[model samples]
Target: MIAYDNDNIAKVEQAYMLKTECLFKLKKKEEATKNNLLLAKYYLDFAEGIFQNDIQGALRCVNYYQKGIKLYRDNGEPQKAEIAHKRLVEIQKEIPQIMVPFSIELDIKGVVDNIKINMEGLTFEEGLIRLTQMFVFEKQEDIKNRVIGEFKDHPLAHMFGKRCT
Candidate 1:
């Protein structure tokens, strides 16, 4: 029992140091500032998880880590969030990606509201389709070009413009 307690204490201390180091590195990666903060928070959370019974300390750690995450997000470092979020998704299978619909009202009414397409674990292709469907009605040539470029061999590309002739 003593050994187990010692192990937990060691892990918590190591995690705390790693979190501090990550925060220090964050000052250097200004562009990836958000990502660094996320990494730090993850380490902090891991440390807190090791000391779950210490209710007050755990709560304090949670608040501090949450604040770090919030600061990064509020500062518009989505790429940083994306990195952490991807890891979260791998671990828990329920991370939400920002899939801005191309046409929210139309697609919501036509497809989402009526059909029960279970795209829970859909691949990138299917996800792209869902994202594209939202903007299908909009007549934005640039968006169309981008979509076509993204899915060059996609069957729908031909419908948008001239075939590769």
Candidate 2:
């Protein structure tokens, strides 16, 4: 058995401060997407610490996560935004389900093989046709050109570039 500390408030504050310091250091790094993801996680952790005592504090933390999602999506980083959104969904489960004013509706299906889209609620038949036309039967040079022009420096870009060359 372990002893419990009565100074829980102090401990939470200390942890929050340490995370804030780490976030400040991360802001200076070049990985903007990674930095935002870490920032959201830290904020969520801090919010979880105070949720029982402070509803406002918990909501503030969720707001910070939403900002991270926006930043990621705006920077052409839908994968990172999806990550933040998933975290937000998990956190939201602890609170009431009332929809927030700034909620975003992302139709992403999966991240494997370059972020498969959900096809905007299309039926199975339509989706199959769209997939076949877009992926299965698309010409090689067209796919290569689109990937190279849009996904420069991406792993997919490098892989396709090698084949193109």
RMSD of each: 19.1, 19.4
Q: What TM-score number comes out for model 1?
A: 0.24
1-165, model 2: which lDDT tens digit per residue? 001432353554345446555766777434544545454454445555655534576576577677657756765678867977897887778655432323335544343333256465788898778776665566899989987777666653342222111
Predicted candidate 1 versus true structure: per-residue lDDT over 32-73, tens digit per residue: 454455445554455346434444544444454454445547
Clashing pairs in model 2?
A: none
Best by lDDT: 2
What TM-score does each of the candidates earn? 0.24, 0.31
**Model 2: lDDT of residue 102:** 37
Give me the candidate number with maximum TM-score: 2
> In model 2, which runs have C-alpha deviations exceeding 4 angstroms?
1-53, 97-165
